[model samples]
Target: MTDVLVLTERELRAAVSLDLDAVDVVERAFAGLGAGGVVMPPILSMAIEERHAEVDVKTAYVPGLDGFAIKVSPGFFDNPKRGLPSLNGMMIVLSAETGIVQAALLDNGYLTDVRTAAAGAVAARHLAPATVRRAGVLGAGLQAELQIRALALVRTVPEVLVWARDPAKARAYTERMAASLSIPVRVADSPEAVVRGCDVVVTTTPSRTPLIEAGWLHPGLHVTAMGSDAPDKNELAPAVLARADRFVCDRRSQSAVLGELRSAIATGAVPEDWPVDELGEIVAGTKPGRRSADEITVCDLTGTGVQDTAIATHALRVARASGAGHVVEN
Candidate 1:
């Protein structure tokens, strides 16, 4: 009988916070998966029912070395009003050679958030300067907090600035996260204020229009745009992308279609000769990061499925060692 590891959201959260080390996991996974190998992550799409306020079933699959992981997520946005989380999802991991179902991770969305935040930190680790000490975070939701935590782990940033459309949430985030992280967290009046004096800026909003503009950035600023995961979503203006000396992304095709590259290319702000680098290339040392202190950098993240696979693998290993999961009989 083949052993299948099952992990819950709570366990996955604990794993990522202490042992999983998302920055390393995401960086290595992208490097290994991007070596002209088998890993492939396609974009995910779904429709919402106006009547039921639920998303219709959608298709998601990522093919890679170990195998493929399929995502199945449901929307329950009103759950928060009822004192519950609004998002929930699962991962179905299959065998590479035998094509048998290996494991089912009932981690809800915790694993995904960890991997996504880790990916942001990985991007910032490569694109941001080593001396960076101030960070600006847009959007005060789960992802924004996670990005701040993960980035702090990878770098020595001692202060963080947060901006949210809602002032109450922003103040609450500053108060809560600052105490937990032992860092000075401040709430900014606007998105521009959040990035104006910061060395690194991370945008986590789901805005259709741009939030961070080009004029607000100074020399040596590193911007990690994490909000634009879909085609219709974009947080950074094309001018902001044009101001960067170097541009990096996780997946080239996806970024071109849905990420900052999409708008940049459409507006002709990023020419054909623009220096576009992949996060995997930087992790593999095929490309350099932060060559100069005055070089402006931007990293557009679309969240790769390979990252999901990597974290899931790590979760299974830890779960098995801790005897934290149950075995379902065949």
Candidate 2:
């Protein structure tokens, strides 16, 4: 008989808090990936067009880790109308040595949210300007809040400008974030306004069309587009990517197929053979990030399995230390 731990969302949340530690774990995962010390497969995605939903399966094995996680992430865009969250998922950790089931992290997508936010923080830590007074967010969802909070960990953001399709939602987000973050949060009139007014911009929408354009870019600007995880979804115009001084992605191969890089390639904005740097390479110190203060940098994050495995591993460790999960025999 084998015993496996099962961690509920509440238990996991109690065990792990989204902070620099989470960022460090994800950064190490990326470094391992860049150094070829991790075994990561291409994401397997399935679309349910009729229901406006998509499911992605992602996994990775870091060489020295005792276990790895396979994450099943499902996004049903229409679920919000039914009073349900658009995102839901879980992770299953397997023993690296014996391939035995170790733990089931029933986070219901919470861990994904934390790890993704941590990745954005890592990007901002490495790519954003040294002094970030104002940050702009192009969404009013949970991620918009989380992304800004994550950025605050690495940079000083005194104010945030937010834009959303719905004015009421944006206003509500402004109120909530201003109070929670203890900073001024204002609503921007448009996506361009948000981009122009802030040195750091984060796009967290699930838009299928371009919300930000190239002409809005300015010197010393840093953009992190985390919305386009699927082939059909795009938040940045191809020209935005083409005009950036440095363009980075979590994984070039995955980006070429499912990220903003794919959209740019599809639209002929960037050639298929164009050289794009990986965030892992920069984190691993094999490549440079933001060489100049006036450089315009952009990072395309389509999400990665390395992040999942790393975050899951960290969560399991914390949970074990805190005795936050239950052990079940099989």
Best by TM-score: 2
lDDT of 1 by residue, 1-330 (tens): 776666677766655552236568667787775555644646455656562334422222334445556656666777788897777888767767786777778888777788888898888777888887789899998888888887877788889999999999999998889777988999899999988879998899889999988999888899999888777888998988888788888877878887888888888988755667888888878888789999999999887777777777667666667777667755
Among all windows of 10 consecutive residues in model 2, the one with the lowest summed lDDT is: 30-39
Per-residue lDDT of candidate 2, residues 158-268 (tens digit): 999999999999999999998889999999999999999999999999899999999999999999999888778899999999999999999999888878998899889
Backbone steric clashes in candidate 1, count: 0
lDDT of each: 0.78, 0.93
Off by over 4 Å in 2: 49-52
